[model samples]
Target chain A: MFEKLDPLLHSQLRLAVMSLLVGVKEAEFNYIKEKTGATAGNLSVQLNKLKDADYISITKEIVGSYPRTTCKVLPKGRKAFSEYVNALSSYIHPNGNE
Target chain B: MNDAQKQLEMIHEMMNKSQREFQSASFYYLFWGWLVFISALVHYLLLTQTNFTHPYAVWATMPIAGIISGIYAAKQQKSSKVKTYIDEAIGSLWLIVAFAFFGLIAMAPALGIDKVYPFLILLYGIGTATTGKITGFKLLYISGLLTFPLAVASAYMNFDNQLLVLALAIFISYIIPGHLLKKKELQMANSDA
Candidate 1:
């Protein structure tokens, strides 16, 4: 009776990341990590999953001597986020459909 | 029901607790608020009390303010990794205001300096009110809207008196709203920690 929540955003850490990026123009990997409280390795894996799905685009660049990774939510990601929210709302509300 | 509810709860909390969202918004308002206030006061004093040929020269301080703003922006960029929609909207709004400020200044000679404060106050009203409305900060919106009347009042006043009106406008619009925003930011940060 309910649409499926986008599995890519269904997880805690990834949803946290998308929630942040969904509002911002873009965010650095470290910033997302700090906010999500996800270990670098775990966040990297999840981020890559999102990237592969074209939900987000990650750019790695050398700023000064260090590399900076910035992630942006593409149109698909934003659409997916809204869909996820709507699906979740309906799923949780139960009687909303009626 | 259970899992979906948990997920929804998480989304709500994360959005609320987003680290340091628009943290420095208050600082700029406060800084520019006082700066304009002081400049306008000095402008009045010079025009009224002193024999200084160029009362307008006091505005030279803006270049220094510009430098400070640039440095502040760079520091903010360095410290912050996320740029929220509010940040983007406020940033673009002020950028446009900056250009319009210059445009008005360029036209000042044609309009006469006495006539310029009304337009400048109008600009101030636009920047603050728009920023407030978009961000849903009530202090900014109400204070910003209050400046419109001041702008109109300044239009009727003489040159030296216009400076006083301008000073009042800055106090209400920028100084008050900036401080309020700053206080709210600190409170939110404290709650987060």
Candidate 2:
């Protein structure tokens, strides 16, 4: 079941971030950080991982004279998330065990 | 499996173990929409059947419900950028119900203006067109085109079955299309699996 899940989205925090991002058209860095309750360093590391996998696109721009980083899940990310969810459900309620 | 493979499997296990704890906006928005759908259906049924003889009785709830649905839509849009078929149908249905509420209110005035309901239907038609454009729902535009002219004609001629006509328009233009969109979504999800 775990093998079928996307390795990029297999982590708890990163999975949470991508799940939230998929629903939202785009989310701010702080939004993801606040929602996941992860420290800036940890969030940055996970975001870089996702960026490397091409699962999420991150854009840095200035908003109100301040730097902002926003994240959006790509179509591939959405498909991976859905597949991850479907595969995960099999583990939760195992088949042929009962 | 190598040590790295074993570590990856363990991490997957740990993630799955904690998956039950994840919470986010998408869950809440969908949960609220489902609640609204159920409650609104009950409200409509009771108001239409048990309320006073005049249609104005239910009109009071129209604006209130419309505002509520609008707020819900705005909240949902914030979370989900992708235009899913589900939201499109729900939004169209919301507008139709809102317009119907106003139509009933206007029709009850006894001001000898039977055109009020027809005008409301026309408003619903426009709403469908706009929703279709925004959500890329071709069926919505088709439904709008079918209802607009019929609404206009109903206003010009005083027919004995005016109530039946209005009911048919709502059933065909809104209710049927709403169900079809829902079915389409379900089919897509199934095929995806």
What do the candidate models score in CA lDDT, each in turn? 0.87, 0.60
- Candidate No. with top TM-score: 1
Which candidate tops DockQ?
A: 1
Model 1 ranges off by over 4 Å: A62-66, A93-98
lDDT over C-alpha atoms for residue B44 of model 2 = 47
Expressed as tens digits, the lDDT of each residue in B129-189 for candidate 2 is 5655555568867876777777877886663334445555655566656666666666655
Q: Could you give candidate 1's per-residue lDDT for residues A1-98 as a string of tens digits? A: 78887878988888988887887778889888888889999999999999999999999987767888999999999999999998998987767854
Per-structure clash totals for the candidates: 0, 0
Q: Specify the poorest-scoring 10-residue window by lDDT in model 1 chain B.
A: B15-24
Per-residue lDDT tens digits for candidate 1, residues B1-193, read: 8988888788877777553376478778889999999999999999999999999898899989999998998878766777777788788899999999999989999989878879999999999999888888888999999999999988998988989989999999999888888889888879867
Query: Total backbone clashes of model 1?
Result: 0
Residue B111, candidate 1: C-alpha displacement in angstroms = 2.1
Candidate 1 residue pairs in backbone clash? none
TM-score (0 to 1) for chain B of model 1: 0.92
